[model samples]
Target: MVFGKVIVSLVSLLLLVGVVFGVVAAVRSRGGSDNKNDSVSSSMKSVTAICQPTEFRDACIKSLGPIAKNASATPKDYMLAAIQTTTEELKKSLEVAAKHNVNRETDPINHDGLEGCKELLKYAVEDLESAISMVSGSQVKDINDRVRELLNWLTAVYAYQSQCLDGLDKPEYKTPIQDGMVNATQLTSNALTLISGFADIFKSLNISVPDLKDLKPSTSRKLLEVNEMGHDNYPIWFPAADRKLLAAQSAGRVRPNAVVAKDGSGQYKTIAAALAAYPKNHKGRFIIYVKVGIYDEYITVTKNQVDVFIYGDGAGKTIITGQKNFAIMKIGTMQTATFAAVGKGFIAKSMTFRNTAGPEGHQAVALRIQSDMSAIFDCSIEGYQDTLYYQTYRQFYRNCVISGTVDFIFGSGTALIQNSLIIVRRPGKDQKFTAITADGKEKSNGINGVVLQNCKIVADRELFPVRFQIETYLGRPWKPLATTVVMQSELADFIRPEGYLQWDKVNRHENTCTYQEFANRGPGARTNRRVRWKNFKVLSPQEAQKYTAGRFLDGHLWLKYTGAPFTLGL
Candidate 1:
């Protein structure tokens, strides 16, 4: 058995070497064309021009110029060659990683890391192979589609190589496999850069390509125009009357329409009573001030209560608590929140919503929001699982503290959360991992996503045993097209290197989920070990801007009315 294993390893290594050498030889042999025509030299210059704009310019030119030396080589041929070269380099790196003796029994972390790298590299190879096949098959009729697909596949290959290295960056492991990964990453990055320059190449060759244009209104343009409308530089989305109301509230010049106190100090004691007493279908803002006390009642702001604002003394001082949970009450997840807001333009401030079901009672939601243009500020949502239910429509959360275990912040809404603290609680014995979000955007055209900007993700150390190991996942797609982006955040060490998780072992949503992270800092901000899902991206500054508060939720048009402070762009 040992001899057979040795033979298999040896054969694999030899096969990897042969594949690399074959491609290299094929490239080198075509270094100079036999013909001396001016047109042939011009085509060679086109290839050089294409490589010049790449990140690894010299390496790209050296590797691809020979492959493009054939006077008959088309843009598709050059792209295929670049992808083939990238896949070959990844295979070489994979072979090197396989040589390491990563035993799970002795060194579980490193072993898992190595095994994960192997899987990622294998996926990288497959991505590139698929790209090559697509280009060869002439399946894509549109030039724009072809270019986009090629760029996406090449980017995936580059990202996968980086992910492999990220998984290996641990104190417990030391291996020469990193050297191969470094080279492979650079090679794939160059390939991606070269592929991205295809438009320029096509332009130079006088090849017709589709006009690249963006039809959506620019966020910067909207910001500038919107700012012009407000004298105090407030968001243009807020109407002058609403702005006056906010100014009045800020100056303490406005009185509440109704007051609710647990004691008999007010006409209405419970929050539900206050809502019931307030006139229904009111177009103007109706303010309800709840005094300091734990209002142990389930509250619902129905659809008829429009533009309602609920304020409390403070988050911890004025609490709303319930014990309903899916496990104990046999309720559906959406119906399990202690507080449910179903109206439009609902705003809440300085209050705590709690589900007292504890960790054993799973899927206990503290707050459920389905209100369009709803905003929560200076609030605390505490529970074990499914804490804050962002059901649908648009919402914004600011300066809030949310503590939970699994899918703590979730829903199908297009929500923007800024400057909030996300606390991942220690799981119960039955739970193995914690997921911060489970977005359910099911359609490609739906402008529904969860964007967490400048937030902090921390673990609840007090809930765990001494030296207990904890792994937190950023999110998993509840629906195939689910989108979530965490940008400019600080992550605690408890966050796993993989960043996001598959929905399940069997019905994995890895390929279709749009999970991304950008410019986040901290020990868990590492991106290399993140899943190599087809749509997962480490976005550029330009791309990340699209998911900012102002852009993602169209905050410039609505957030100002809620009186929640937010940044206009990333």
Candidate 2:
């Protein structure tokens, strides 16, 4: 009996040893395969790092570090996350731009649609460049495949328009059904081109790329939908719909509160009238509540108008309109604007500033802000050329709609747009639609930049195809290392896939410009094929969040009194 028991124990021990040896052998085999995969992923990572813009390299590192850990301990997983995040961001930007333009829903030419288109393309190209270079050993792709697809998609969308323009005919519609067919063709072509690019890039990197064509057509459509309306990013400070609730005081122009437009002696018809009466270099916050009316006048809040708050009944109710073109005015490139604000800490709410310069013109800036710690909320700016200018310093716009025909939002300032609307109008018969932002002159100390978040974009003229030329940019590296970020936004099909434009003769595409995006979605947001990665990219989610108003825009100081919700998302 003792010998039999001992034999049973020995057999059990032997069985345990065999199982352990088998497990060790399996682990070793898996380790070898994992090392090979890591090698490829690591190579891809180095390439992507090399392609990233120098100024934004730190942002890229910061963004990718955590994602790498979360992605199965493989560099490929992290790279894929980066690519996906970038594609989503560009899509969001385009969607915001498209929605903003559609809200006005007028002809692209009449509504400054051309300028809007230009700006969209500019930023699109900038983002495409980044997406194109994003690579992964798992996917085995280079930046070229994405870039080619992006270019083809953009070309397909704009090809007919280019043809129409080449034919010297104004944008027009064929039969409604025919127009739909054309749109379908453009979309189909875009998908095919993007798929080809994706496949080619994967082939180059010794990775098996998916045949996007085999995927359901709805796949791309669904992605576009997810991108356009998704609100992953926080809209904590919507300057366009919020009130700047300035502390009330007994100073400046104050009379009987008035029953009607007549306030006894001189109660001031509009806030502009009151501002004109106020003494220069006045201390404290000056409140100017404008009554509801379309005031057709040009305003200049000079440096003397410091620490003043201008409020109105509502932004749409108090409309300011003017008909002026920088070309006709013969102002120099730097000085070509309609309204110039050079004051410090200026605040405005519930106002509509318009420059009614038609497409046959040059720069016509509607509102040029050049102040430090300035905020504009719940406002509507309309113009043909330079519409909302960031002359200098830092400024924030929330819940506002900006419409223009040319480079509408441009300049050198630390500007941020949250939950706002941007419209791009079709340019003149011979021109293009360049819209959104035009940032020049990079600066240290967070002085010169622009960021757009949770916004909608739209374009006029359904069949109107717009080209994103070199001059149009979401934001330029005007001052070397010019920084612009669009994060977790929506983009419309109207956005060209090329993504960004360059300033005429500006050579900062490689070294200084810092353009990045994250978590964007839309038909226009697909980055499987985009521009060269060496020149542009999709930022990691962590890097992209730094541009948020609460995180980067003075830590809620500007939004505190602006009446906007402080909704910092987790």
The model with the greatest TM-score is: 1
How much does candidate 2 score in TM-score? 0.52
* TM, every model: 0.60, 0.52
Q: Clash number for every model?
A: 1, 83
What would the per-residue lDDT of candidate 2 be over residues 398-467, giving only the tens digit for each residue?
7788887666787666678878887777666655546466665422322246788877766655224643
Q: C-alpha displacement of 267 in model 1, angstroms?
A: 2.5
Error of 1 at 354 (Å): 0.7
Model 2: ten consecutive residues of lowest lDDT: 1-10
lDDT of 1 by residue, 138-229 (tens): 53222222433344345445545544654564643434777777656766767655544434444554644442122233233232234335
- In angstroms, give how far residue 303 of model 2 lies from its true place: 1.5
The true-structure Cα RMSD of candidate 1 reads: 18.1
